[model samples]
Structure formats: structure tokens, C-alpha cells
Target chain A: MKTILESIALTKIFKTGKIEVTAVRDVSLKVPEGEFIAIMGPSGCGKSTLLHLLGGLATPTSGRVLVDGEEISSGKDAVRTDIRRRKIGFVFQRFNLLPTLSAQGNLEIAQEIHRNGSRDRQHVDEILNLLGLEKKTHHKPSELSGGEQQRLAIARAVINRPAILLADEPTGNLDTRNSMVVLKMIQELNRALSQTILMITHNPEAAGIANRLIEMRDGRIVSQQQEGEWNAAEDRMSL
Target chain B: MSSQLILSNVVSRPMRSLATALAVGVEVALILLLVGLSTGMIRENSKRMSGVGADIVLQPPNSSLVLAASTGAMSVKIADLVSGIEGVKAVAPVYLQLNTSGGLGLVWGIDQESFNGITQGFVYREGRGFQGPDDVIVDDIYADARELRLGEEITLMNRSFRIAGIVEHGKGSRLFIPLGTMQRLVGTPGQATMMMIKCHDKSDIPGVKAELEGRLKSYPIFDMSSFAAHLEEANRDFGPIKFFTRTVVFIATLIGFFIIFLSMYTAITERTHEIGILKSLGAPQGYISLLFLKEALVLGGLGFVLGLGLTFGGRFFFQLLMPTLQHQLPPEWLLYTGILALFSASLGALYPALRAARQDPIEALAYE
Candidate 1:
């Protein structure tokens, strides 16, 4: 399989009042096309920071991140932003959808920012249907339930058909039923569209749905496991 | 695509800020209109004074006020002496009598041939030239008020003359009659109030003024160009009134500025988060600034239109209420309105545009 994203010795250090804290330390990661991977970590383990770095939202202090075999981080700020817009899509823990726009308008805004003119109601409807959000197209984020708003954010993230969808705590605010629905949709999108998805979550059960799982502790990956093994342990824990 | 979305967002939000901007714009426009009207009046007066056909005015010393007040005089003999001056194309001696209305009315006695050579026949709405030595040409205002018309005989200074025509002059009410007849009626044969001189060379105004002033130092010699300067001097003479009007305009514009600033500041505050959303969505800082500018310009434009209409309408209404408002239209209206629109828009947008442009995308996005 062709590697869609590769990071070599990715490191990030943040300064907070006379101390330099390592958020991600010399972390190297590889994500292939059509792969579903989850990065599971305890609180402050830098899983979200890793995802942000991979998504081009922040620059790594010392490392290289390549998307589709292209080195985007070495160029100017404008070029990095363009790559972020064209190649990567992000889903935040808080949904981050503009409260003023309706669900449909929110999706439209994402498409517009990317300068994708082929977007239409039909495309929006298809994504909404996939996420079971067809009936709530006109609803504002404030009016929608937490689960629905998260689903809408997911729909918006994948609407541009990015090479990779980076979701940070995609279902952190949802109940078990809604979380299962979102997991199934992410799985289906990966299988059907050959889309690579990198999701971050602390829930082992949530991580169990990915094809592979990497566990992190103290800004370093400590373990890697297949989906079957992770699921079996999660089932045992639930029992 | 980003620009279109930003525009839609800005337009969709409706609040008190928009109303305040519109109000500021309206006030700015009204102020512009007022300034335009005043400047227009000055320009119109200048035009009428310098317009072709009326070349010279003869009067007693301090005749600027006298002509404005329509008082004082020069003997008829001076008119005859000036008529013989070289390059004196045509001459008409004028006599004046103050009426009960407190306005000066000219009793101009001209030889039929010399008058036609010098003064262009007044633009008459309803009449013809003097038919005989006893006939007269009255002003439109005086004729309209008194219900007099052409061929109707009227008495001035106890002499009856037929109303030959009703005329329009930019300055004052005037009645034209035959020279011999006017001299007999006013008891001043071969002696006139003042003479109107028409020169052969329009460019030789300085030479004529010098020659005439030197010859008639006892009397006042006013060329047409001097009237414009005299009007400026007159305006300067009423120093307090000029200062007061300027100060009032400045205060009114400053008030407009404050209203615009408050409106824009509130708008920026309310939209800080929205602005962050836009920036995160990839809107450039310049585009964000443009949005605020567009709002200010819209407000200014609407206000200017409203104010211009009000000013112009007020001018005509004043003319209707008092007939002396005819002197209030000119080219300066264009200049003042343009300046006011620019001033109001810039004053209103300066701070708001800077604040909007300097907003940080990260902080704005993180705002709750």
C-alpha cells in the first residue's frame, strides 16, 4: 500500500513560564492509504498534539512530515496552509462548527474555503445520509443534539474528499449508541472510498474499531496492537 | 469563495450598529448639503456679477453697501461725461427710489438706441420693451406682487408710465424708462443717479477702471469683477457670523464622527468571534477590513443622498417663502458634497477597520 502520510522524528516543544515541555518527542509515524488507525493515550500524553502536527495546524520543532510524498512544511506559511486546505481534513473534540451557520451551510462553507466549486446539495445530502443527518440539514449547531453536531462535523471534515481525515476525539462527547454510529461511518468511509483516517481517543473500545491501535504514554508510543486483540480485551473488560 | 461567504455573513447580521451607521451617514450628508448650499450661493452670486452683458456699475462712494441696500446716488451729469470716454461702448444712467418694501428699485432712463447697445434686454417672462418716453420696464418680483403686467400703466414718484415689460435681474428690482422722461419726472434733467458703462475691450477692464476711477475720484467706480471681491470682503466684514457657521459645521461633523465610531466599535466587538471564524476559514486580513469599509461607505452614501435632496429642497422652499433665495445655486455644491462624503466615511471607518484587521485568528477562535 502507498504511504499517504509519513513523519520522521517528529518533535514539538511548548514553552510555558520558564519551562520547556515536550508535547511530542521524536515521534515517527506512518499511515498508509485506506488504513484506519487510532492513537490512544492517557491525559497529557500528546496524542492531540501529534494529530495537530500531522494535520499541519502546527509546525513540529524538529522533524519532517510528508503528505502524499510531498514535503509541505519546508515551504512558506501560505504554502503550508494551502496544503492543509487541499490535503487534510480535521475533526475536533468540540465539533468547532460555526454556531451561526446551519448544518448545510457549514458544509458549504468548508467546500467554499477549499475553492471546490463541484459541491452541491446532492453531495451534501450523500454525506448527511451516510452520517444519518438528512433530516437536520437546516439545524444550527446550537439547536442540534451533541451527537448530531459531532456527526455534522464529521460530515464536514470528509466532504472535501481529503487524502486523510484527522479526527481528535471524534466521539468524546457522544453516548455509546452515537459513538457506535460514528465509528461505523468512519469504518465504512475508509473501506468504500479508500480514505485514510487517523482518530485519537482514550476509550479502548473506541480504539478497538480501528484496523490498528498505537498506545502512547508520556509523549511516546508504548504499544501497538491489532484490532482483533484490542476488541477482545475491550469485550472482556465490558463483561 | 471566501469573499462571498464573508459578505453574506456581514449582511445577515442585523443590529443597532447598522442603524447607527446609517444615522451617522445621514447626518454627514445633511452637513455636506448645508455646506454645498452656502458655497453654491456664493458661486451663483459671483456668476451673476461677472456674467456677460452687464460690464460696469456707477455709484457713490461705499456703493457696495449702497447697491446691496439700494441707497445713495451720483448726479446725472457724470453719466454724460462717462459716455464720452474713449472705448465707452454704451452708457445708461440709473436713478433709484426706495419703496415701502425696503428694497431698492431702479428707475433707469436710457435712450432707446444706447440702452439696446449697452444692456441686454432683461429676460422678460411677460412683456416687451418700453413703447414710449412714458413707458417703463418693471422687475418680475415687483410686478408679480403688485399684479402689474405689460401695457398696464403704473405711477412711480408721481409720474404715470405704462408697464412696458417685466424683467429679471440677479441683483435688485429695476424699472427702465426713457432718459428724457425719467429726468423730467425725477426733476434732474441732464443729471443722473449713476451710469452703466459697457466697454469695447472686455480684457481692458483694469485700464477702464483706472481711467474711470482717476476721472471720477469724487464718485465710486465699480467694475463687474470688483463685485465678486466686494462680496468676499462683505463676507469677511461679518466675521462673527462666518466664524459661527464654520464652528457649527465642524461640531456637527465631529458629532457625526463620534456616532460612526461608536457604531463601528460596537459592531467590531460583537463580531470578534465571527471574525475569528472567518480568519480560520481562510479569509485574509485585507478582506476583513474591506467588509467594514463597505459598511461605512454604504452608510455614507445613503446619508449623502438624503442630505443632498433635503438641502436642495430647502433652498427652493426658502426661495418660495422669501423671493431673495434665487442667489443660492452654484458649482461649489459639487465640491463640498464630495469632501463631506470622503471625510465622513474615513472618520467613521478608521479605528474599526484597524481593529478588525488586527484581530488574531487563534484568539478569536478560542473565544467562547
Candidate 2:
């Protein structure tokens, strides 16, 4: 399968006073087309930082990030922004949708940013229906429930048909039932649309749904296992 | 969507700020209009006074105040001597006399050609110019008030003269006659009451006055330039009133500026997060600035229209309320007001626009 996104020896360091803290240290990863992969790590393990680097939201201190075989991480701000806008879609835990915009309006803004003509109302309807947001199309963010708002954010992130979808703990703010609903929606998008997804989660159960799982500790990946192998490893660890 | 649509969206969100900006624009425009009107009136009056073609007025010694009052005139020989001086353009000896008709009239005796050139072709509204040597050009207002018409005879200073034409003067009414005719009528054939001198250049005034004064050291030569100086002195005497008017306008403009500034600042603060969203969505800083400029433009346009209506309505009311005061509309007033509205609106929006443009997309997004 063709690699939709690849990060080679990616390193990110942040400075606070005289101390330099490494967020992602020499991390290399590949995300192929039509695959659901999850990065699992403890708190402060740089899982979110890795996701941000892959989405072209932040520059890696040293390394290369390639999207569709094109080196996008080394370009100017405008070029990097264009690459992010055209190729990557992001969903955050907080559901960063504009409060003033309706669910439909939020999707329209994404479509506008991509310069897509005559907003794809049919596509929006399909997404809303798929995510069970048909009844919340005209509702503003404040009016929507937390789960509904998160689903709306997911709908907006995918509305532009980006090459890769990145989620940073998308289900972190939802209840157990809503988390299941959101997980099902993610599964449906990955299976039906064949969308390549890289999700960062601290929940092992959330990571179980992925075809592949990577475990990280202290800013470096410690192990990678296939879905069946990860289940077997979890069973052994439980024993 | 077009940039214009985006601008409309931003402006439409804050209706109260827009209204405040409009009010400021109108006040600035009104003040500008009043100043422009006053300046235009002064200029028009000056031009009309210059058209009378007199550089200096030769009056009797110690009779400066009396001559200004038009109560008496000077001797003619002094006028003849002034006319013989080099750089003297032309001199018309004039006499002022109270008629039996109970009206004040000037009996100016001049050569017809010289009179026409000096007056810039004074048209006779109803009759003809002086034809025979004994003919006179009657003042239009004096003729109208006294029911005097062309071909009628009028007795001035106890001498009869035919009224040949009715002349219009914006300032006041006066009668003109030929020098020979005036001598034939008044019986003062060799004497002139006042010398109206037209100098070659305005700069030659003081020198010519000194020379003429040397020749007639006992007489007083009051230059028309002195009348201009008197007008300037009158304006200086009214300095306090003019200063008060200016102070009022300045205070109003400052209030207008603050009103627009505070309103725009508040509106921008409300939209801080929205602006961040726009910037993160790929809107350039210039585009954001354009949004605020468009709002200012709308406010200025609306205010100009409202202010224009109010000014004209106010002028109409004044005309109706005080029938005695002349209240002609000066076009310069409208032009200046429109310009001032544009300037004030732009100035008022500038600082707020810079602040909005400088907002960080990251910080603004995190503001929530």
C-alpha cells in the first residue's frame, strides 16, 4: 500500500527558561492509505505532539515529514499551511468549532477555506446522517451536546476529503455511551470511506479498535504490534 | 464569498457602533460646512468691493471719520493733481448729496468708457446707458423704492437730470453722471468733492499716498486700502466670538473622534475570536483591515447624507424664522462637509483597524 504520510526521525524540542525539554525524540512512523492506526502513550509521552507534527501544525526540530511522497515540513509557512489545508484534517478533544456558526455553517466554513464552490449540501447531509447529526444541522456549538459537538467537529474535519485524518483524543470529553458512538462513527468512516486515520489516545480500549497499535514512553516509541498480536500481548500482560 | 460580503458580515454584527460612527461623521461634516460657508462669504464680499475700482479715497483733513460716514466730500483740484501723478490709473471725482426725495445718493461723474471698464460691464436692467451729456444712471434700489423710471427727470442737489439707466449694485444704490453734466447741473463746474483714484498696482499705494500728501500736506488722503484695513480691524475686534465658534467646533470634533474610537474598539474586541478564526482560515491581514474600512465608509456615507439634509433644513428654517437676515446657500459648504466626513471617518477607523489586524490567530483562538 502507498504511504499517505511518513515521518522520518522526527524530533521536537520546546524551551522553557534555561531547560530544553524534548517532546518527540527521533520518532519515525508511517501511516498508509485506508488504515486505522492508534498511538498509545502515558501522559506527557508526546502523543499529541507527534500528531501535531504529522498534521504540519508544528515544525519538527530535526527530521522530515512527507505527505504523498512530497516533503511538506521544510517549506515556508504559507506552503506548509497550504499542505495542511489540502491534505490533513484535524479533530481535537475540545471540539474547536466556532460558537457563532451552526453545524452546517461550520462545515461551510471548512469548504470555504478550501475554496470549494457551492457548498456540498448533499455531502454535508450524508455526513450529518452518518454521524446522527441530521437533527443538529442548524444548531450552534453552544446548543449542541458535547458528543454532538465532537461529531460535528469530525464531520467538519472530513468535509474537505483530506488525504489523512488526525484525531487528538476525540472521545476524551464524552461519556461512555457517547464514546462508543464516536468510536463507531470513526470505524464507519475508516471502513466505508477508506479514510486513513491516525488517532492518539490514552485509553487502551480505544486503541483496540485500530488495525495497528504503537506504544510510546518518554517521547520515543517502545513497541508496535498488529491488532491480533496487541490483543495477545495484552492478555499475556494481564496474566 | 466575496470580500465585500465578508465586510458586510462584520459591520452588520455591530449595529450600535455603526450608528455611533455615523453620528460622529455628521457632526464633523457640519462643522466643516459652517467654516467653509463663512470663508466663502468673506471672499465674495472682498471680490465685490474690489470691483468698485477705487484704490484710495481722498478726503478733507481731519475728516476721515466724516468721509467714511459719507457726510462730506473733498475739493476737485486735489483730485486733478493726484490724476497727473505717474502710476495713477484713473481718477473719478465724486460728490454725495441728500436729495429732496429723502434718500442718500452718490453723484459720481466719470467718462463712460472708464466707468464701463471699472464696473466690468454694468448692465442696465431696464433702460439704456447714458446717451446725452446730461443723462444719469440711477441706482436700481433707489429707483425701485422711489418709483423712478427711465426717461423721467430727477432733481438732485437742486439740479434736474434725466435718468438714463437703472444700475444694480449688491452693496447699495448710487447714481452716475458725466463730469460735464454734473458741472452743468450742480453749478460747481471747476470743483470736485472727492477723488476716487485707481492706482496701477496695489503696491504703489503707500508711495502715491505720501507723494500726494506732500503736495497737499494739509489734506487727508484715505486709501481704499485703509477701508480694507478697517475691515480687518473689525474682524480682529470680533476675535473672541470667532474663537468661541472655533472652540465649539473643536470640542464637537474631539467628542466625535472619541465616540467613533470607543465604539469601534469595543466592536473589534467582541470579534477578537472571530478574527482569529478568519486568520487561521487563511485570511490575509489586509483583508481584515478592508472589512473595518468598509464599515467606516458606510458610516461616513450615511452621515454625510443625514448631515446634508439637516444643514439645508436648518438653513431653510433660519431663512423662514428670520426674514431680515440674508441666508443664501453656499455650495462650498456642501463640498467641504463631504470631504470632512470622509476624512474623519477614515481617521476614526485607523487605530482600531491596526489593533484588529495585529491580533494573533493562536492567542485569539485560545481566548475562549
Candidate 3:
């Protein structure tokens, strides 16, 4: 498999009124095409910050991030924006849907921006159906359940067929049942469509659905396990 | 999609959008109504001046073109001298008094036979003109406005006068009294404000004007064409009224600017997270800015239409309140006012839009 995303010696530091905090230390990682990878850590371990750096949503303090062989970490904002619209999609924990727009409107806006004002209605309907949100396309975010809203958010993310999908705590706010449903859909996307995905979560069960699991501690990747190895490890831990 | 977003945002907050649009509408209506009144008044005055049917107007030196501003400066004897000039057919001595009883109006005191000769005659809508010194011949507009009937007594200049006739408008002042009576009331016996001169043939007007210029040195002589132009020029300046109109325009522009600025600014503050979502979706800065501007454009367009409605409404209201007041709705002015409203709204939204566009996506996303 080809490496679709690569981060080299990534570091991130945040400053507030002369107080500096190191969020992420020098860490390097690579994601291959069609792989489902999850990063697991406790709160405040810089998992989200690392994901942001990889997605080009934030500039690293000292590092380089490459998306599909293009350097995006040091690119201009316009260049980064172009790359993001063309090749990257982001799903946030909060759903981050425009409240004023309906579910279909939310997806259309993303497609509009990605395609520079052109839309593919067929693709949009397909994505809506795939997410099981076809009947609720006209419903506003507020009118949708937690699982439905998150599904709508995911549909919006992949509506334009971006090269890679970055999901930050995709099911953090959902109940166990909904979380399983969302995780299963994500797993199906990777299996059926070969869509590359990077997810961050605190739930080991959610991480269990991924082909690979990377555990972080203090901004460093302390351990990496394949699906079989992580499953066996989880069974032993439960014992 | 952008349009849908803009519409949804505006519809989402009905009261704010409506109030902002109403403010813009009021600004536009003020400009149209003020400009309309002044322009209409000028046109009406010019029409009446032309309707006098005089080939030339001879005024006392230093007298104003506005008859209402003229005093009894020259003696009525000037009419006789001009009538004696070659090609001179008739001359009417007119003593003008500015009446301020009910409103600011001009009262023309005229010599009945000569005034009739120069004007061909007043087109009487009711009765005869000037039956006595205390009888006033009002124009039809004035009669209808005041709800007066023929032979009804009305007080003017602190003196009672009967309505001898209601003549068609556009021949001269709305109220006409005998020249001798006006001269006596003002204590300026034999004095006239100006003389309206007619020529035997229209071709002889230029000759008569030149003759008067040579024969009556230092006196102001204007042929009908120049007189009409002068009236239009005076109307254009309109002195104090012109100043007032400009002041209103300046204030209206500022009001429009501040109203849109505050509205957009508040909207931007409220939509920070939405803006962040757009930014994260790969929306360029210009797109985000354009979204806000399009919203303002919609508001301005609605406001412009509403402004026109308010303008016509105001015109009708004023017509009922003051019948003699004239109003004109020039199409060019309507277009300019529409442009002005849109420009003010766009200008007002510029800062907020750019500010919203420049927001950091990360910080904006984190905004609670």
C-alpha cells in the first residue's frame, strides 16, 4: 500500500501569556491507503492536536506533514486550503454542522466548496442513502438524533470523495449502540470502498474495529498493534 | 448554496433583518421625498412664470427673481415707460406681497385690464376676477385645498376678502388682489415689485428687451427665455432648502452605514462557529466575505423597494395635509437613491465581513 499521509518529527507547543505548554513531542507516523487506524489516549494527551497537524488544520511547531506526497505543513494558507478541499475531509466530535442548514444543505455546502460551486446530485443522494439518512435529508441538525447528526456529519465529510477522512472522536458523544453503528459504517467504508480513515478515540472497543491501533502517552506513540494483536491483547487484559 | 445560506440566515432572525431594512428604507425615502419636493416646487414656479404669457419681465434693480422675496422697490410708472417703447404692446404692474398667515405664499397685486392683456386672460373656473378691492381671485388648487367657494370670505394679510373667482392654476400666484389695494396696504403708493411686458408680436421680444435695456439703464430686464432659466437656476440652489437637503443626505448615509455595520457585526459575532465550519470546509476567505455581502445586498434591495413605497405614501399624506405643495418622482433620482442605499449597505458590511473572513479556523472552532 502507498503512504497517503506522513508526519515527520511532529511537535506542537501552545503559548498563553508567556506560559508555554508542549502538547505534542517530536513524533513521526505514516498512514497507508485503505487502512483504518485509530489513536487511543486519555484526555490531554495531544491525540487531537496530532490529528489536527496531520490534517493541515494546524501548523506544527517543528515538523513536516505530507498529504499524498505534497508538503502541506509549510504551505501558504490558500495552498493548504486548496489541498484540504481537494484531498481531505474532517469530522469533529461536536458534529460542527451549520444549524441553519438542513442535513442535505449541509452536505451540499461541502460539495459546493469542494467543487467550487458545482454539485453531483447523484453522489449526494448516494452518500445520504449510505449513511441511512435518506429519509431525513431535509431535517435540520437540531431535529436529528445524536446518531443521525453524527452520521450526517460523516456524510458531509465524504460527500466530495476526498482522498482521506480524518475523524476526531467520531462517536465520543453517542451511546454504545449508536457508537457501534457509526463504527461499523466507518469500517464498511474502509472495507467496501477502500477509503483511508484516521480516527481518534478513548474507547478501546471503538479502536478494536480499526485494522491498526496506536496508543499514545505524553504525545508519544508508546505502542502499535495490528487488529489481531490488539484483540488478543484486549482479551488478556480483560482476563 | 451561498444564496440559500444567506436567505436562511436572514430569515432565521426576522426582527433584526426587518428593522435594519426599515432603517435603510427610511433613509432612501427621506432622500427621495426631500429632493422631490424641491424639484417639484422649482418646476411649478417655472411653469407659472411661463404661463404668465409675458415676452419679458422687467424688475427693479437688485430685486430678487423670487417674487415672494421682492419688496415694493420701483414705482408702477416703469410700466408706462416700457409700454411707450417701440414694439411694446402691453405692460402689467404687479405688486408682490409674501403672505405668511397660513403658509408661505405669494400674493400678486395686479392691474386687472393690463394683466388680462398680458396673460390673454385668467381661465376662470368659477366667477369673475377682482369685483372689488376686498375681493381675491384664488387659483383652483388653493380654492380646493382651502375648501373655499366663490364669494366666501377669507382673511389674508390681516384683512378680510371675498373670493371673487377660482381661476385655473399656473397663471401666477394663487391669490390675486387689485394692484391699488396692495399698494395702499403696504403704504408704498404707486409702487410695483416687477412689470410683466408683452410684445405686439413674439418676434419683437428681442427688440423690446434691447430697447428697454438702452432706455432704462441699471434696471433688470429679462426676456421670457432668460427669465425661465433664471428661475430654474434659483430653484437649483434653493439656498437654505438646498443646505437642508444636503444635510439630510449626509445624515441618512451615516445612519444607513451604522445600521448595517452594527447588524453585520453582531451577526458575525454570533456566527463565529459557522464561519469556522466554512473555513474548515475549505471555503476561501473571499467566499466567506461574499456570503455576508450578499446578505447585505438582499437587505438593501428589499429596503429600496420599501423606500419607494414609503415615498409615495409620504407624498399622498402631504398632499392631503397641504394641497398646494407639489411633489415629483423623477425616475433618475429613484435610481440614484437605490444605488446609494445599496452602496451604504455594502460599505457598512465590509469591515465585518472581512473580519469574519480573517478569523482563525482553529480559534473560531473553539469559540463557544
Error of 3 at B187 (Å): 5.4
lDDT of 1: 0.70
Please provide, for model 3 over A124-167, each residue's C-alpha lDDT reduced to its tens digit, 9 standing for 90 to 100. Answer: 88999999999998998999999999999989988887788999
Candidates, ranked, DockQ = 3, 1, 2
Could you give the candidate ranking by TM-score, starting with the highest? 3, 1, 2
lDDT of 1 by residue, B1-368 (tens): 34444445445665553565456556655555455455545555555445435577777754543333444556666766777777777776655443333343435566656656665656778777777788887777667656776788787666677888877754323566777786776576665565667888887666777788888786767787776677555643455546865776677667667776777777788778767655544444555677777776665565566556666676667567645334343456446654666576667777897798667554565666
**Candidate 3, B276-351: lDDT as tens digits:** 9998898988899999999998988888888999999999999998899999877899989999999999999999
Q: Per-prediction DockQ scores?
A: 0.17, 0.13, 0.77
lDDT of each: 0.70, 0.70, 0.89
Place model 1 in a CAPRI quality band: incorrect
Fnat per candidate:
0.12, 0.10, 0.75
Which lDDT value does model 2 have at B317?
Answer: 71
Best by lDDT: 3
Clashing pairs in 3: none
Could you give candidate 2's per-residue lDDT for residues A1-239 as a string of tens digits?
99999999999999999999999999998888998998998999999888877876677899999987877678355556667667778787878777657788888777776663356778888888878899988887899999899999899889889888899899899997888778888877898999999999877777777888999998999999887887544532120
Q: Candidate 1 chain A, which ten residues in sequence have the lowest lDDT sum? A: A230-239
Which runs of model 1 end up more than 4 angstroms from their true locations? A72-75, A116-122, A125-139, A175-177, A231-239, B1-4, B11-13, B23-27, B43-80, B83-170, B173-272, B275-362
Candidate that beats the other on TM-score, 1 or 3, i.e. the better one: 3
**What DockQ class does candidate 3 belong to?**
medium
Worst 10 residues of 3 chain A by lDDT: A230-239
Model 2 chain B, TM?
0.49
